[model samples]
Target: MKKLRVGSVLLAGIVAAGAAWAHGGATGIVKERMDAMSDIGGQMKAVGRMLRAGSYDPALVSSAGATIAGHAGKTLVDLFPEGSLEAPTEASPAIWTDRAKFRAYSDELQEAARAMKQLADRGADMQEVAGAFASLGGTCKTCHEAFRIKK
Candidate 1:
């Protein structure tokens, strides 16, 4: 189909673009943050899948929450040193310009993740864990919306 061919080409172009800028090739703070953010996204997805399945494992959720909370706020900001937006960075200039707001989003993420971790640690039910997870995801969504460049 003509439409399918056009869509496939577009997909390949996007894949090739990211491969060209492979995060490994990017050295310094850019790579560090890229890896860290990738880990965060992975952990979030793992926990999200568990929560969605309704067969959640509390310990695993707690562990993922700890990992996310550990990298929130200051941990995130420290990785983004001045002018670290070289290549393979989703960061936007708006982050540096609106540093306070960005920091707030980081803090929000930490708070939400910590809350979720606490609930999971206490052997809370799926409902409680899901609520906290939603809060944490909200912070991520909010931060990405404002700071991340759609690549």
Candidate 2:
């Protein structure tokens, strides 16, 4: 009877430890956030192409910009942590090695996205909107150049 109780306690402890470890293993989190970001990228590209063709509705452009801001603000930072560098995670060890710079890129992305949302919300004139869009694209390019690996 005593042996059975001890074995049960050991099993419970093992299960709890596993759950804790799994939470810290963020490879899937990174992948999911990256995929979501890519979806936003594709949407942004579509909106830009439409704008270039002079057929893009301002409403649609604002909607896509809002979506990007929302996702980038909420999900981008949560994806990176101390142990996020794993296979299928293009997140380089440099992310963990150079934590400050990594965090700066993340902050810059969020800040840019927020600025985009503000510009989009204000329904500014097309020239201002186009310049804001360009600035947002520049932010993406800056971060990608620093941390993200190109496929």
| Every candidate's CA RMSD | 8.9, 20.0
Which sections of candidate 2 miss by over 4 Å? Answer: 1-27
Clashing pairs in 1: none
lDDT of 1 at 76: 91
Which lDDT values do the candidates have, in the order given?
Answer: 0.75, 0.59
Candidate 2 per-residue lDDT, tens place, 42-82, comes to 65665566545455367766777767776664356667767
Q: What ranges in model 1 sit over 4 Å off?
A: 1-24
- After the best TM-score superposition of candidate 2, give how far the Cα of residue 17 lies from its true spot, in angstroms: 41
